[model samples]
Target: MDGDYVIGGVFSIHYYMHTVKHNYTTMPEPLSCTGSIDSRELRFSRTMVFAIEQINNSTELLPGIKLGYEIYDSCASVSVAVHVAFQLSGGLDPVFNTGDKCSQSGMVMAVVGESGSTPSISMLRVIGPFNIPQVSHFATCACLSDKQHYPSFFRTIPSDQFQADALAKLVKHFGWTWIGAVQSDSDYGNNGMASFLHAARKEGICVEYSESFSRTHPRSRIQRVADVIRRSTAKVVVAFTSTGDMRILLEELSRKPSPPRQWIGSESWVTDPDMLRFSFLAGAIGFGIEKSVIPGLRDFLLDLSPSKVADSPLLTMFWEEAFNCRLVKSFQ
Candidate 1:
């Protein structure tokens, strides 16, 4: 904003509304990797602070009750602005603490957009591993109770820890002898892969190779993962990347004369209507995936609202964004 306005913090139970008046810089950093996303030339601020602020503006532009807002200056990177905000938060408390950055625990909802580094479902602890929004939900899994707090921190997604156990059971059931491991470079990826490895190894399952991809770098994400599958001693490859990244890898693998010995996709690997527009992940597999679950998860997610009509900016952004993309194709 302009000069001095006291906003120690911000608090909105379900709706996130903020009037951000700050300078945002417009500079593009483009990178490529084999991961799900091909290449995005995002303004540096969009990743963290800028992204939150944009969502805030979008919330303003698009009014909603369940919106998470991030405020920032127009001329700064998300990291720089966040560091400044964190230091700033020490002296004063905000009116709202979206998920992280403030200790006032009540209930916070984390929107899983880009399962970039790890599957959003994999790592949920916002405070521990990554100190990101994911942990806010995880914190609820601990001894603390959100019932006691006003703006409690809660995660709606199923946990990867739980997913890992289910997947490991599936692996054992199928008698899969070996698996290759691929992950995005983030807490979700790291933790999920670790869980996968632990589960498989406990069952005497062999991990062929473990590889990680950078979210910001897409150039080699696909190729390296496919290459690992092609050349590795293992058969199935466990992935922590998003469906977008999975689509790319699967499409590229389909292109190869040879293919992975067998494919084991995370639950994140699912079909969306817009995913097919790019025509990447077709022919990757038929409708044969072992299902995983979190007990009471579906009910829990559905229970987020007393009715289906409860407005959510984050959900609107998600489906709107998804609707804008191409759905996953069955074949070329």
Candidate 2:
């Protein structure tokens, strides 16, 4: 925490957590708290720390100026993300009343992420007027390219417009004119699916049906979407969805005996190790961003010790999940 400039970060450290009854009669309570740690997102958050450490150690980058950071968990929810944004801006509580301002001596100069586009957009509204730059590592919604609206927002990944074009071209190459589309019910999915629909129309492709679902939605709604997918005659399905959203639908599909259809994946779940467990997605193809290996990232992650990171509540949660062990405190 000793540095000239503090970089803020927001990541979806946990996946969506909800329960459903066998008959799906009653609605479950809303997600009122953060869930368990998502190991995939933990890697990205760790990489951010690694990058900052690398820069701080470099003699040429800052010339004796040390870099530090304050990272928060977004939980992949807009409400949670907004609360974290206020904390990053030095708010005393989650509530955002008028006349509130950052009173911290060393304020953050920039923020690194909120992972998904919806959470990023929510955080932008809270921090944009302050002129704090937010650089997202994974948010890819096409709407964020608007300089007038999100002037302080930036991302390392390509926009969804480019991915939509690639998906359209790939479908056309295979001579698949009729297809079905499924996307997450968030800014990323809505905007990306809209762009893909426009691109698909221009390419002379016909979409048989388009459906969307969210993690917090009722189980019956997700079941309806699954039923639509099963009844559809389209042999090709373009899924522009997050891992959490897709997992719900996949679980529903697994219950019924159905033929495997060609699935075109989005970057969100294409390389996800959890998604690969579905045998039905074996032949699925999708677009992924270029990959590069950081020199010491692997060793750094493997060397994480509980004692070294015991002070960090976030890292403590990560340690419990990663190792399935609990630590004892003196007070306890």
Best by TM-score: 2
Q: In candidate 2, what are the lDDT values of residues 81-148, reduced to their tens digit?
A: 88778777763334545556645444578999989999999999989988889999999999999999
Compared with the true structure, what per-residue lDDT tens digits does model 1 show for residues 1-332?
A: 21122221111111112234445675433211111111121111123333344545564654552344332221112233233334333333345556657553322323322222222223222222323343221211212223342132334345567667666777788787677778756555567767878887888888768887743456566677677678877756667655444555656666773543555555545333334543433433322234466444445334433123125433333334435743332332
Q: What does the lDDT read for residue 184 in candidate 2?
A: 97
TM-score (C-alpha, index-matched) for candidate 1:
0.45
Best by lDDT: 2
lDDT of the candidates, in the order given: 0.43, 0.85
Which regions of candidate 1 are displaced past 4 Å?
A: 1-152, 251-257, 271-332
The residue-level lDDT of candidate 1 at 330 comes to: 34
Clashing pairs in 2: none
Q: How accurate is candidate 2 locally (lDDT)?
A: 0.85
- List where candidate 2 sits over 4 angstroms from the true fold: 17-33, 91-104, 309-313, 319-332
What TM-score goes with each of the models? 0.45, 0.87
